[model samples]
Target: MSRRILRGFSRDEFVSCRERAGFPSRADLARAADISVGAVYAWETGSATPQVDTLLKVAAVMGVSISDLVVVAENDRHLGDLRVFAGLTQPQLAKAVGMSTTALGALERAEVARLRPDVAAKLAEALDRTVGEIEAAYERTRKRPPGVAS
Candidate 1:
């Protein structure tokens, strides 16, 4: 599938944050982030979005939260957005929370009518959201049209 930047990941914000964090160059940020400079360039240029793992490292090095790197409104966030905010790949998160990637994807796409309470608890813990927030996001996802994103 295509690698679209999760909604709310601002390249300009990333650049500004990097600068504010005192990294004078992408190479410097890369070194601090323990990733390739090319990756930084790619993300900045919108040629590619950074992986969750890479973004996680970069966020740590820059002393910013993942949400700082990718800004989403609290109420607007959905399951997919929660995953991204946690800096986890779908597979990674699925594995952590003991769900199939397909199932997670389905939830993200609002393929189901409602989230199971147990599943919601798992997702909440994994994504660092409250159960109510998870349910609310799921509701938002359900209300949104398919092919849309948060």
Candidate 2:
């Protein structure tokens, strides 16, 4: 049998989470992720999807598993949410995980296809979360179902 593609979250959920967390603007997320405010809008409005590398960086900042941002069944994922939960600035998270801000941004944006094992391990340690959690969250986002695609 073929595995069904799971859907993710909706844009409203992303916005709601941010608002509830007291981060009411894309600029806030941009600052945290070290990305342009336009990029934050794109991610929030479904204009663009972040690269995997960028996704991880965002996750680190938000203090969540990449899966937490994913709206499974809706196909919507919010790396920004993860970043907010992690509560780390891009530079701080990058330093903790032993990567340059540029490299971290690449990961958060999913521009890089895969993370080096060592780096991933270090990220897991610094985030005070397990490597398995990070990997599992990444795995859940492999397929984009309808309604959640960016």
Candidate 3:
């Protein structure tokens, strides 16, 4: 069987998440994710993307989700704004979702490339809002026309 290599990672999302999380450097994030510094660099540069398992680990360590690291849509809520409205800080809200402060910050800023449904559940629970509300916030931020694929 021939294995095809594909590269479609979101560099901005990776960097934004790392920087927001205060990893200090790419090496620090790599160490935390138990991956090589080169791998981190590769993802950030869009040279390569991690497989699902690795991506999950990366998300766990970064306190984000696969969607946050890879998905791209225009209409997203300032996750931080929701937290603020609910009277919480990044660390506080992150704890509610078992995520990192940086991850929360990235979500709030919409710096993440995508927002997955599962992650939305966590955010919804943490923010004391319904999942539909959260979804609506993201939906409002989308730049798509009706029924268009984002």
Top-down TM-score ranking: 1, 3, 2
How badly does each model clash, as a count of residue pairs?
0, 34, 6
The lDDT leader among the candidates is 1
Off by over 4 Å in 1: 1-4
Q: Is candidate 1 or candidate 2 better by lDDT?
A: 1
- Tens-place lDDT per residue, model 2, 44-130, is 888766554565576556665556665543223333223333545557777887778877766654546775678668767766656
What tens digits encode model 3's per-residue C-alpha lDDT throughout 1-150? 111122224778889988888897999998998999999888777777665456667777888765676553424433443554454545667798988777765665455777788989998988888888777765553533554321
Sort by lDDT, top down from the best: 1, 3, 2
Every candidate's CA RMSD:
2.1, 10.0, 11.7
Mark the 10 consecutive residues where model 3 has the least summed lDDT. Answer: 1-10
The C-alpha stretches of model 2 lying farther than 4 A from their native spots are 1-81, 140-150
Candidates' C-alpha lDDT:
0.84, 0.56, 0.66
Better of 2 and 3 by lDDT: 3
Q: Give the TM-score of candidate 3.
A: 0.44
The alpha-carbon lDDT assigned to residue 126 of candidate 3 equals: 82
Task: List TM-score per model, in order.
Answer: 0.87, 0.43, 0.44
lDDT of 1: 0.84
